[model samples]
Target: MKIYLLYTGGTVGSVGKPLGPLAGPRFVDAFRANVETIITSQLPGTTINYDYFTPTLDSTNMQPADWVRIAQKVLSNYKKNDAFLVLHGTDTMAWTSSALSFLLPGISKPLFVTGSQLPLFFEQDESYTLLFNTDALRNVLGAIQFMTFAIPEVALYFADTLYRGNRVIKSNAREFTAFSSSNYPALGRYGVLPVLNERLVRPAPSTNALNNHIQKVAADLNIIMENINRSSVIQFLLFPAYYDRTSGDSLIVSMLTQLSRVNPPLRGIVFESFGEGNIPDFASMQALLMDLSTSGIILVDCTQVYAGDVNYGAYATGAWLKGAGVISGYDMTPVAALAKLVIQLARDPSSPKDEIQKAMSTDLAGEMVIL
Candidate 1:
C-alpha cells in the first residue's frame, strides 16, 4: 500500500538558517529530500511516497482558508493513494485537526496528521533518533479506512499517542508533550510497535460511494473568530463561578474597568457562577448586569466547571441571572464562547441586543451542551 505524504510548513520542515528570530529553521528545498534522508533511509523498507504543498506555509499563521485548502488537497488526491500522512505544525494543530474532522465528513482512508517539536533537522539529531527507528509510522499504514463511522475523522499523533482531534487541546509550547486528550481516551499508542486499542478506535459503517458527499455547513452557518482588535465590538468577559458574591473587591472592579478601557467597546460581563451555574445577584451587581443587558452589550454566565450540562433553572442565582437577561453559555469554554461571540458579530454585524444572546445559546459547531 502506498502512503501519500502531504507536507505543509511546520517545525518538521524547518532547517537551520542565518537570520535571528524567524530564520531558525526553514524549508529551503523540496520536502522529499528530507523524507528520503531522515525518514526512509532509517526505516529502510516502509512503503511510502511523498508530496508537498507548494510554498509550504508556517502553521502559526494558519487560518480558516488553510483548512479549506487542506480539505481540497486531500480530495484532489483521494483516489490514487491508499493512505495519507500530513506533516503539520504543532501549534493550533488541535484546532485544525478538529476543523478537518468536522469539515471532511466521509473519509475512508487512514489520514494521520503528525509533526515534531524540534524540526527534523535539529542539530541534536532528535528527529532521526525518535522517528526513523520507531515502528509508529509503519503500523498506521495497515488500516486505511475509518473503523466505525463511514467517514473517517482527522487525528493528531504526538509523543506516541493518537488522540481525537475534537477532544484534544494544545497545552505546551516547547516540548514534545505539546497536546493532551483531556476529555477523552487515547485511541492507540506507539511504543515498540503500533498497538491498536480496539476499544477506542471506533468501527466504520461500510457505505456506498453515492452516500458520500461534502456537507455545505459553513456558508449556511454563521462562523468566525478574532482576537481583541482596535475595532472589535466585544466588551464584557463573564467569569464563570456559580456562587454568592464573595469576591467583588476593588481589584476585580479595577481589572474589569482596565480591560474595558483598553478596548472600551467590550461593555458587558458574566461570571460562570458556582454550582448549578449561580452567581450572587447583589443589588449593585444585578444593576450592572441589567444595565449591560440594556445597553446592547453581551453578558454571559458560563460554567467554570466541566463534564456536565448547564442547569439554568437549578439554583436561585441561576434563576436570577436568567431573569436579568444574563445569557447562559451552557458548557462552552471561555475560549469557545469568546470565539463564538466574535463570529456572531460577523454573522449579523448589525444584530440587536437580544439577538446576540439568542445566537450564543444555540449550537453551531456542536460546541455547546444545551439542556
Candidate 2:
C-alpha cells in the first residue's frame, strides 16, 4: 500500500540535542539510517513517500501557519496516496490533529498522526548524547501497520492506543503513555496485533460524489483571497483554580479590555471555563462578554475538568454569562474547540454566522460526545 508521510520534526526523528528535533542538516537521513532495518525487514513491501517541512520548528513553537501548511500538503496529494501518516512532535501533535479534523471533515482516507515521547532515532542522557530507544521505534512501526486499515476519520496513534484526533490530548510529558482520550474511547488498540473497534470508528462516506463534495469545500478554503485571513480567531481559558476574589475580576476586566481593542474583530473564541462550564460572574466580565457576543464573536466554552461535558445552567454563578451568547463546547478538548471554531469561521461561500454556530454544536466528525 502507498502512504503519504509528513515529517514535521519532533522527538520522533531526533538523535539528540539542539539540532536533533529540528532536522538540522541531515537528521532525516540519520533517522532513516537508524530505523531502516525495521522499516524494510518487518514492514516489507509498503511504499512510503515522505515530505519534510523546509525548516522544521519544535512543536512548542508550532504556529497557526504550520497547520495551514499541513492541511494544504495533505490536499495536494490526497488522490495519489491510499493513506496518510504524520510524524509530529508530541508537544503539539494533538493540537495539529484536532485542527485537521475540522479542516478535513469526512476525510476519505485513513489519516494517522503518530509520534514518540522518547525519540525514536535516539535519546539523551545527562551529557546530551544520543541513546537509541528501540521501544519507540517499535511503536512507530506498529502505528504504520495500523494506518493501512482504512480508518476514515482523523486520529492520533501513540502508546498502543489510537484515539479520535479531536478527542485526544497530551496528558503527560515524561511517561510512555504520553497521551489520553478522556472523553472518548480509543478507536483501536495494539497488542500482538491491531484490534480495531470498528463500531467506534466513523466510516468514510461511501459515495465518491459525497467525498468529492467534501474535498471541494476544503479546496475552496485554500484559495488566496484579498482582505481575508484564515487565522481570525482567539481563545481564552479562565483559571478558576488559581484565582483569588480580587485578581479574578481584575484579570477578567483587563483581558476583556484588550480583546475589545483588536481590529477587525475575531471570528470566534474558545472560552475554557471552570467545571461544567462556569465563567466568572463579575459585572465587568459579564458586560464585556455581552458586548463581544453582540459583536458576533462566536464564544464557546469547554470545561477545565477532564471528564464531564459542559452543562450551562447547573449553577447561578455562571448563568448570566450564557445570555451573552456563549455556547457549550460539550466534551471537546481545548485544542478541538479552538481549531473547529477557526475552521467554520474560515469556510468559503462565507458560512453564515448562525450556520457556523449550528455546525459547532453538531457532531460533524465524531468530536461531540452527547450526554
Candidate 3:
C-alpha cells in the first residue's frame, strides 16, 4: 500500500506553549523519527511519502489559491500513489476539503483530510514528547488505516468518523469531534475495525473516463487557478431587522445597497438566511436583491440553521427570494455553499447568471440534497 501524506501546517504539526506550527521539513523529520515506527509496525509494507507546502500556512490564513495548490499536487501525483492524506488545520479544513471535491470531481481513490484541535506534540523538559492522550495521533492513524479501504471520494476524518468532504462543517472549536456532517451520514466509522457505510460512498468512475477528466482538468489548471485567485464571493448572515420606521428601510437593506456598489462589483453571495431560508419581506430588501440578480450577481439562499434544507417554497417570506433569482442551497453548510460558488465562478467566469445559479442548485459533489 502507498500513501501520499501532504502536510499543510496545522495543530497536528505544532508544538510549544503558544501552539504555533513547526517548519514543514522539521515536522516531517520529527514524524519519521517519533511516529513512523508505530505506523510501519501496524501497517507492515506500507510505503508512506511526505510532502508539504513551503512555509506552511495556518488554516485561518488558507485561501483559494491554496486549494488550487493542493488540487494540483494531488492531480500531479494521482497515478503514483494509492491514497492521499492531507494534514490540515481544523479552522478551514472543511473549506479546503469541499473545494477539492469540486476541483477533482469523480475522484476514484481515497482522499482524507484530518487535523487536531490540540498540538500533536508537546514540549516536556526541553524535549519533544508524543501526547498519547491527544486526538492528533488517533485521527492520523485512523485516516491512514481508512486509506487502505480505498473509499472513493474526498472525505474528512476526525473523531472516529469519516464524512463526505463537502457535507461537513466545523461545528466546534474545542472538541476533538470538531466537525459535523449533520445532513449526511458518515462514510465510515472507526471502532475495533473501520466499518464503511458502502451505500453512502460515491461509486467510482471508470478508469478511462476518470483519466480523461483528469487530463482535461490538468489542461485548464492555470485558468482555474487564476479565476479562483481573482474570484469575489462572500457570505452574509441575515439577522433580525432593526428598522428605521421613518426611512421605511432596515439596516440590512442599507448594507446590501452599499455592497451592491463595490468596485469590480460583487460576483456571488451565499446568503445565510433564517430558518428554512426565510428573509425579511421588506420592499427595499427585495428590490436590491432583484437588482443585484439582474446585474448578474449569483444569489444562493442557504439556511442559517445547522441541520435543515433551504426550502424557499415552504414559506411565503422565502418564496420571494426565488422570484428575485435567488437559488436554493439545500442543506449545504455555509462553507460548502461559499466554496462551491467560488469554484463554479472560477470554472466559468463568463457563464451567464442562470448558468451559475443552475450549477449552484445542482449537486456536483454531494454538497447538497436537492429536493
lDDT of each: 0.55, 0.74, 0.87
TM-score of each: 0.59, 0.88, 0.96
Ranking by lDDT: 3, 2, 1
Q: For residues 1-371, could you state the per-residue lDDT of candidate 3 as single tens digits?
A: 78888999989988776777878888888788778888999999888899999989789899888998999998888888899999999999999999999888768899899989987787666466788899999999999898888878999999999999999989999788899988999999999998999999988877633456767888666678978766578899999869764566688988887887775458988999999999887777778888888988899989988889898778899989888988888899889999889888888789987788888888887888788
Taking the tens digit of each residue's C-alpha lDDT, what string does model 1 give over 1-371?
55666767676656545311122223323344444444445444445565566667678877655665665566666676666667777776665666565445555555667776665543334332224433323322322222212124456677777765555667787666777754357777766666656566544425622125423333323132222131243334345333344654433344554555445366345454565677666655666566656766677766655444457778766788877777887765443455456545544556786777787788644455576
- Clash count list over all predictions: 25, 0, 0
Model 1 segments beyond 4 Å from truth?
A: 17-31, 37-55, 122-151, 202-211, 214-371
Worst 10 residues of 3 by lDDT: 205-214
RMSD of 1: 6.8
Whichever of 1 and 3 has more lDDT, that candidate is 3
- What ranges in model 3 sit over 4 Å off? 124-127, 207-209, 244-246
Candidate with maximal lDDT: 3
lDDT of 3 at 204: 81
